[model samples]
Target: MTIKIITPEYVVFEGQVDSILLPGKQGEFQIFKNHAAIVSALVNGQVKIYTDSVPEKYSKYFTKENEAKSAYSFAIRSGVLEFNNDKGIILAE
Candidate 1:
């Protein structure tokens, strides 16, 4: 499924992903392909995206030594994730 992660500043990520593990307010939730439509709040934790399409040049974009790790996680504080039909959208604050 395609997943889009966005922040107020800019779009963080947009691409195909195998699955997503999100930090839900009640508890952790996992989203797969063709998930039912819904919307929920996010908590302070890691958002894990499982994918295999890593770009080589991305390693040079970050000041940290592990810029490649950005392909999987975004430590979100408070936000919302919406899923509908075949699309998944995450809006982080």
Candidate 2:
């Protein structure tokens, strides 16, 4: 699945990910490939993206969280998430 994280300034991250963990208003939730469509409000927290690799150009916007190099994280103040048809987008503050 593909995911994009965008803010007012610029696009934070955009890439294919195996799964995503987001901080929802009620609690944290995880989304995997082929999951049902969803739209939710996000709170200030971290967003974790799991992928096989990260392109060098976009690596700067993400923090390496594990030795395997398959997981990365980005921080957001707040955001809205929309996911459908194996794609997800986050519009952040």
Candidate that would win on TM-score = 2
Q: Give the TM-score (vs. native) of candidate 2.
A: 0.93
TM-score against truth, every candidate: 0.80, 0.93
The count of residue-pair clashes in candidate 2 stands at 0
How much is the lDDT of residue 87 in candidate 2? 91
Q: In candidate 2, what are the lDDT values of residues 1-93, reduced to their tens digit?
A: 999989999888888999999999899999999999999999999998999877887888889887556888889889999999999999998
Which pairs clash in model 1? none
Error of 1 at 59 (Å): 6.5
* Structure candidate 2, residue pairs in collision: none
lDDT of 2: 0.90
List ranges where model 2 is wrong by over 4 Å. Answer: none
Model 1 C-alpha lDDT per residue in residues 1-93, reported as the tens digit of each score = 888888898777787888888999899999988888889999998887777753443322213224444346667888999999778999997
- List residue ranges in candidate 1 displaced over 4 A: 55-71
Q: How much lDDT does each candidate structure score?
A: 0.76, 0.90
- In model 1, where is the ten-residue run with the lowest total lDDT? 56-65
